[model samples]
Target: METIGLIAGNGRFPVLFARAARARGLRVVAVAHRGETEPDLEREADSVTWVRVGQVGRVIRALKAGGVSRAVMAGGVNKVRSMFSLRPDWRAMRLLGRAAGRGDDALLRAVSAELESEGIEIVPSTVFLQDIVVERGHLAGPPLSEREAADVRLGCRVLAALGPLDIGQCVVVERGVVLAIEAVEGTDRTIERGGSLGTGRAVVIKAAKTGQDMRFDVPAVGPRTIETMVRSGAGVLAVQAGATIMLEGERLIEMAARQGITVVGCDEHGNVGQS
Candidate 1:
């Protein structure tokens, strides 16, 4: 069986990816972050290694030794926490020192380039999970109200503006009023914070960077996102169609329907799917 490398971060994405790969007869060699990755990863992977947050050289060595020529990054590492928690190894330190800025794209590009230098290609995170990638449509609950659709349009504008700044991919809006924008705190927290501020019937929008690099840090949404939105009293969840990974999408849609949450996958122009 061909062995693929999994550089896992926090969340079920890694676990799901490993399971999917194994189901298709691939052996997975996973290098999980010490505290960020779930412990259940070992059970899904053929082989697993643990590494600290900033152990770049160690990761390279481990993947190389396992004969992993290609790899994908799954899940997320909390950016704000990682800033304070990182213990950079010599290689990571050198890369960071020469990096243009500390933005997510810059740092990931540097890491990907370094990995390529060592003959390890970084593949798109969605490589094995295309079936779950969201398509353009109203996926659950009721179709968004006209007001909600407008809110999604405004949120897309907000995200488009934020993208160039590398600020975030999500925005919360209600009746064209922006509630909260996601920063390092992440999507779920952003939804909660924004939902708390709105009068009612808030909409959450998540989209890809205008020039998103799929090799790392791709958009990931699953059951937890739906649950958070339900608790936050957010009524609509819209993601960038074809660019977002809607993990466990059926369950997400079912849960959202039960909670009266509207879920959609749309393009940047906010064309709601045909009924």
Candidate 2:
């Protein structure tokens, strides 16, 4: 059986990927990051190796040893934790030094290069799980009301302004006014913060960076996102089509429908104003 390397991070995403890969008869060789990846991954993977957050060399060695020629990154290692936590191994230190002054893209690209140097190809996380990628159209619930659609447009404008800065992927808008922007705190916090400032009917927009690196840091939302919106009183979610992942999409949509939250997938060039 062919073995694929999984660089596991946090959340159910890695678990879902492992299950899908196994169902397809692929042997999963996973490197689960300590304090980041969930422990349940060991039950799903064929072979699991625990490694620290920045142990690049060990990851490469583990994959090579498992005869894995292809790999996929699943889940996210909290960027905030990387700021204070994480002790880098020698290989990670070298890669970080070489990637000085670069952002997330440069860092992941450098890591991808190191893996490729070891003859392991990094594949898109959607490889066997394309169904979870949100499709274009209104998903779950009814279409946005005219007023909510107006907010969607305004939120899109806000996201466009923030995208190039790599500040955040989500924004909250109400009545044509921007209420909150996501920063280092991440999506859920951003929604909660933004929703708190809105009139209990804010529209949330999440999209990829203008020139986002697909290999890592793709914008993602799931069941928890809807729960956050519900908690924050946000009424609608408008994510960019073809650029975001909706985890447990069907269940997420059903929950959103039950909550009466409108979910729309907008095109890259489409303006929220056009709605």
Task: State which candidate has the highest lDDT.
Answer: 1
Instruction: Name model 2 segments beyond 4 Å from true.
Output: 100-102, 269-275
TM-scores of the models, in the given order? Answer: 0.97, 0.94
Which 10 successive residues of model 2 have the least lDDT summed? 266-275
lDDT of 1 by residue, 67-178 (tens): 9999999888978788999999999999998779788888888988899999999999788888988899889988789999999999998899888877788999998899
Give candidate 1's total backbone clashes: 0
C-alpha lDDT of all candidate models, in order = 0.89, 0.85
Q: After superposition, how far is residue 107 of candidate 1 from its true place, in Å?
A: 0.5
- In model 1, the worst 10-residue window by lDDT is 266-275
Q: Which digits, one per residue and each the tens of the lDDT, describe model 2 over residues 136-177?
A: 777877777888777777777777787776667888888888
In candidate 2, how many clashes are counted? Answer: 1
lDDT of 2 at 148: 79
lDDT of 1 at 199: 66
Best by TM-score: 1
The residue pairs found clashing in candidate 1 are none
